[model samples]
Target: MFSKSKINDPVTGKETDAPRPSAPQAPASSGAPAPKGSDFKASAPKVKPPASTLSADLHVTGNMKTTGDIQVEGTVEGDIRAHLLTIGESATIKGEVIADDVVINGRIVGRVRGLKVRLTSTARVEGDIIHKTIAIESGAHFEGSVQRQDDPLNPGAKNPPSPKANPGS
Candidate 1:
């Protein structure tokens, strides 16, 4: 059943033919010569960075910061800053959450600041939300106000005057 390639049987001093697999050819549009059989492998597609995950049994008490995305299924007692943050259904966060995109499906007890914020049907939020765009699903429980801002991620932006203050008082 073997093909043309030959192998020497050391014990019998006989040559036997073996089937040889061919290398994969690269597309002509790649602009490169075909790789040798021993060195050829299929090109891999571009992959995004992996998201960091906090499992349901974990609990964190300090600030967390990352330029990449994060998926939290645990509890966190401090602030979080990331490019994208997903709070899982079992998660509970007690501090600020600042990200470019925030999807909350759990519980949060502090402020939320993001460019785009979404509270899923199972979400429970107890503090203010500052976002450029926000959506709260029908079954989400939010106990605080949501304020839109041009730059919700910037800490240096001026805060609105307190509603309780009277200009003459």
Candidate 2:
């Protein structure tokens, strides 16, 4: 058997008296090839996350403006202006909401004004709501007034059914 004192370095092409490390550090522009297993992990390309392809995905850190339909299931601390806005059950909004058609099944701590609005049983609105048409379910809780847009034209007409207030209050 060859003695340990006589070892060959494939990179330097010389027999060294001492045992060298596993891999050699070659100069960048040198024609010398790299070790198979050592280069893969060090020069591997980083895997990137896939891009989003949704029509409306609001991840706003500041004020947001849109003219199309939107579904908010994340936290939005700024005002939202959209044509049709749907606040999912997991959403939390702390700003004003303006939309032509609004549906809320989440928590909102700001004023919501729309032409037509529907508050689902899971909705919790702390601020007032101003709308032309409104609908509420059996378990809905709202602390606000309901005034129809037609009421302004015909002031003497009877008021519509008012929204029920919080039962525990």
Candidate 3:
């Protein structure tokens, strides 16, 4: 009484015998069993993290080059090469500022070459400031021109105010 090794039931054309592969595979997380020599290198090799150092409320969207040190409290439209730039007080720059050390407490419309510039009275500049050392803290709202960029052999000797008059005329 041992009949087994020839089964066939193509939807009831019936004929059976032959089935045994010791079926049991359900544990590799529910579909079981497969772990005895997977060379498990003690788990710890899944790293991907290195792109964070833009603090001061950061809201930049394009064109920003840094060599180290950047602090701007939101709003940037493009063009900012940093080596040390800090314009926080709800910062807002529209473009162009090559830094070496700049500190303005908000609002710049463009053009500011720094070597050392500080305009903090809730500053609001509208362009043009080539610095070598400048500080305006009397309710600052400067409209440009404060050049004394360390005398490059006297480039027209410190006489600013004539880009078309009105610098205390």
Candidate 4:
């Protein structure tokens, strides 16, 4: 009997065990030769992962950064950077926030920088906000100046005025 082994393929989502190939065959006189074993595999498109969440019982004391999304229901004492950040009604953040999208429903004690920023009715912000676009609900309590920029997430960038798409467009 020939040898066999299992290979978990992510593209096919299967665990397959096929018999190993026999001894090597004579090389073909082609520019590129065929592989000796089973070598064909498909590439799958990457899927976006679920947002990471910090529960209300958690309290973080250092900076947090991620390319993915985050839902915070706890307290954070340092800066946070993410692709998308959601602050729950019971959450509290004590440092700067930089993200592509920011949805605030709780309290923030520092500056907020985002491409799009939304302050819900439960939001309480005490620092300036730098965003490409912003929306504040009627009941939101905000004690901060708001500024618009083409790129607000880049802390060190001396942002110049960038043309924004008109609402009608």
Candidate 5:
């Protein structure tokens, strides 16, 4: 059975006793308010950008460069450059890593240069680290030199000369 039901217009705050039409009606004028729920339906959908990930069973032999974030759960034999880099516990890297933020929970056999570097408890690193700031957890294993630099991301920057010792002191 078909029956007509009175409905209230959200924009105009008026009640209409007319029967609802099966088809959508065009706007009468350009200044007319939109129908109820029309604003939500007309709005664009929100979407998030995807992050690059290397799976545990995969291996990469070439350099990787990205302006976005990267998560590595596999082995990499080449250099990596990104905005943010995360190394999983089961991952292994054999080359240089350059990023703004680098979190290592795996094994690294090459140099690491970043503005901020963190080595988790399970991390094992065998190469030098050049960073503006760095943190090593209690259980982390490191077998290389660690240097602090004012600009760790710039490889061509020269370090300031140390102060000379006085002979009469």
Candidate 6:
């Protein structure tokens, strides 16, 4: 009953069709049918998001966790877990750090755990480091023990079970 309606064109003062037919959509893939309302785009590549930055004057007292990258230029008193964590030259962290990649150019007093960890020449670390791979530049002040593991991100799991999700904000 509501299929046909005349829309007046304001510019030309002419009648126009109100209901327009939608364009036909091709299947997302050539082989298997994609689920309805699937918005995945194969051609549009996903880019790595920019790191969340904490300014030099800011101070955080609680835990921080994310699946994305984080760059700290301030002070954090609690533990941090991220995909990639970068400590700026002026940053100072008092708790443990866990990430896939950890780059420290500042000071950290707690344990560091990562798949890859790097300490720049200006970095100062006082806690032990557990990493699959680690690099320390010359003049880096580190007083901690270092241990290498094949899967440093997971501390004690021998056989691969379901991955543990880190709870965080």
What TM-score fits each model?
Answer: 0.68, 0.53, 0.23, 0.71, 0.68, 0.69
| TM-score leader | 4
List runs of model 4 lying over 4 Å from the truth. Answer: 1-42, 161-169
Ten-residue region with minimum lDDT total, candidate 5: 22-31
lDDT over C-alpha atoms for residue 19 of model 3 = 28
Best by lDDT: 1
Model 3 C-alpha lDDT per residue in residues 1-169, reported as the tens digit of each score: 2333223233433322222212221222334343788654444587744433455566786778867667788888887877778887788988877777788999989878777888899989898888778788999898866666663123344645555776554
lDDT tens per residue, model 4, 1-169: 2233233343443423232222211122222454668563333468999999999999999999999999999999999999999999999999999999999999999999999999999999999999999999999999989988887988777665435745455
Candidate order by TM-score, decreasing, is 4, 6, 5, 1, 2, 3
Better of 2 and 6 by TM-score: 6
lDDT for 55 in candidate 6 is 97
Residue-level lDDT for 97 in candidate 1 = 97
Better of 4 and 5 by TM-score: 4
lDDT of each: 0.88, 0.69, 0.71, 0.87, 0.86, 0.86
Clash counts for all predictions? 0, 0, 11, 0, 0, 0
lDDT of model 3 at residue 20? 25
lDDT of 6 by residue, 46-100 (tens): 7988999999999999999999999999999999999999999999999999999
lDDT of 2: 0.69
Model 1: clashing residue pairs?
none
User: Candidate 1: where are CA atoms >4 Å away?
Assistant: 1-46, 159-169
lDDT of 2 by residue, 1-169 (tens): 2224224434565545333432233333233555766543434476643422122245566667776777788778888877788888878888988788889988888888788889999998878777778888667767756666633222245555455655454
- Residue 48 lDDT, candidate 1, scale 0-100: 83
For every candidate, C-alpha RMSD to the true structure in Å: 9.1, 17.7, 18.9, 9.3, 9.3, 9.9
Q: How does model 5 fare in lDDT?
A: 0.86
